[model samples]
Target: MTLTVAAVAIGLMVGSVTPLAFAHLAENTPEERLGRTMGNAELGREVGDAGGPLAVGAIAAATSLPVALTALAAAGLASGVLGRVALRDDGRVRPANPPG
Candidate 1:
């Protein structure tokens, strides 16, 4: 019961912050290659969220829930950081803009 309530509150907080966060983040998103950038973001999110189930089902099989949850949270944080770097306009992840 307590966990459910806490999860609900966290969900609500994320929902509320999402739009505000996106408002600033969208501007930082490279408009030129936006399609690819958004695609990476989408893929990152899908993999991160889905990975927990797969990872837990395998490695977390013997681990306690708290430990598993913490590991999942760390994975999520790392993904978020990676997404920011991956979406940047730098040639590292994003290729240089095509010549006109």
Candidate 2:
């Protein structure tokens, strides 16, 4: 019962952060690449959404549900650390070009 509750809470927390990532992507992307970037983002998201559960299920089958969930939690932590490093920027901002 406690594990189920923790899983649901973690899932909700992770799901809630996706939109913030999308917003960051949208902001950093060049205007010309916006559509392609968004499409790629969507594709990646779809693949993750479909594949994550299947992978977890397979892991659970091979080992146990708790092990599988722990693996996922570790992966999430790794990704969060990597993302923070990759997205870190100094405070400098380039001025936007005046419209022609």
Best by TM-score: 2
* Per-residue lDDT of candidate 2, residues 1-100 (tens digit): 9679869966975797678889998988778778998999899889878988998899999999988888877877787789889899878784443243
Cα lDDT tens digits for candidate 1, 4-100: 6645654564466445445545655557867776667567557745875788566667876556556655654675578568665654553345444
lDDT per prediction? 0.59, 0.82
Error of 1 at 75 (Å): 3.3
Off by over 4 Å in 2: 92-100
What RMSD does each model have against the real structure? 5.8, 3.1
